[model samples]
Target: MPVAPKRMPFFEHIAELRKRLIVVVVTVVVLALGLYTWGWQIFDFVLRPVQSALELAGAEKLNILGPFATFTLRFKVATYAAIVVASPIIIWQVMAFFLPALKPKEQRYVVPTFGTMVALFIGGIAFCYIVVAPTAFEWMVAQAGGNSVQVLPDAALWFQAVLLLLFAFGLGFQLPVIVFYLMIFNIVPYNKLRANWRYAYVIIVTTAAIATPDWSPVTMGALAAALIVLYEGSMLLARIVLSRRIGEQKRREAIMAAGGDPDEIDALDA
Candidate 1:
């Protein structure tokens, strides 16, 4: 038997949140410290795609304008890497803080949904790095007129741009998971999403345009296309889940009407 979660007073809740936040901060800082030791290697890895793009355009390497620029860039890179590395702990802390407030059925969905979100986030980042970054950078390089203009990008700006794009794509890929929960909780109907797909497409395109770091149409279009697919796929899955839930509800209703316990019916069915 599962033990019921204990409810805390408002002040206690605040204290608990503070504790979790402290844990999350400590974890991230520790991870950051570890990453700082290898910050140069990580920076080089992050710079690889841009370097390739620059090479393809026969451009020079990125420039560091200030004395502290490299140090600052490495620190920033380590921080970003730390956040990525500590994401699971951060998420767990967040979930633990809020899980007590959710109903049992809602709680059941949390773990699976969180897992899906993490997988989608990683997939999105991978897509941005492997496909979007290279394509966008190549396009930007091409616009510089093939060695006519010096293509010396600022290292700091380049890192910021890549990190922003990666974060955007990772968060953007959570659309399906968000949609799934909305449908599961009956906050949004699957039919409604299906009906409003045109509006959804506009929203997706606008979001992709806004989220992408560069103004390259190829990158925006790719993100939009991927989001649309995820949205449609989510809708389809939501429909199936909704159908099964409705069927189960109807079956329970029929069982109750026939003077049979729904629990026993479920047990028998199982």
Candidate 2:
């Protein structure tokens, strides 16, 4: 008689998941505390661009909002910073959860995917903080030049808007990485996507327009143009990848066609 295979307890899987969750929670909390200690400095750094914009536009000092607003704002900034700092750990935890189910080749894709996600997010944040935020603020300030519009930036509103824009751009900048990965996975065919390029441009421009809160046509056009360029760049990359794969496939078929014998150089009898 064949012996029955032993079954592992279901709780073992649950325990493993629980352990990862605990690690992520503890790491985030510790980082949050560390960030809180330096929260004021971090907040100041984030606000510097806006501060400079206001100064350049000859606006007066930013009038902060109600009591306890400073403390709350610092806490929010620290929390966001901690989240950013702990992203790798969080990503690892998420990837680990699916580790058992992935094949070897699929497993190889994980680290690169994680890295790409992180890089894209950082790029997006930088784009927002460095390019989009400053330009948009300058434009907004320029709009108020003729009128005696005193800019009293509410601490809460300013920070909120800054965070929103930063995150929006950062997430937006992931387009190329996302599309390339989709192509790699064969989720979307290259020819099909290429054929729909016109529609894609329209959608990309629309997305950029929606993402731009201030509704400046120039800013929207800039962001959309950037995204479209990235889209084309991704397509070029995907083409190289697909071409390589096709060449390998053709070589394999050639070998197979040669009667499964590399030495065979002439037509064989059936």
Winner by TM-score: 1
State model 2's lDDT: 0.76
Q: Which candidate is the best by lDDT?
A: 1
Q: lDDT tens digits, residues 1-270, model 1?
A: 122246889898888888888888998898888899899899888877667787876656677898998888888889999998887777767777888888766787777876887888899999988888887887877888855576677788888888888888998998898888788888987778788989989999999999887857988998999999999899889889889888877887788889997577775345
| Alpha-carbon TM-score of each model against the true structure | 0.92, 0.82
Residue 9's lDDT in candidate 1:
90
Candidate 2 displacement at residue 10 in angstroms = 8.9
Error of 1 at 206 (Å): 1.1
Candidate 2 clash figure, as a count: 1
Off by over 4 Å in 2: 1-21, 56-60, 99-101, 145-149, 259-270
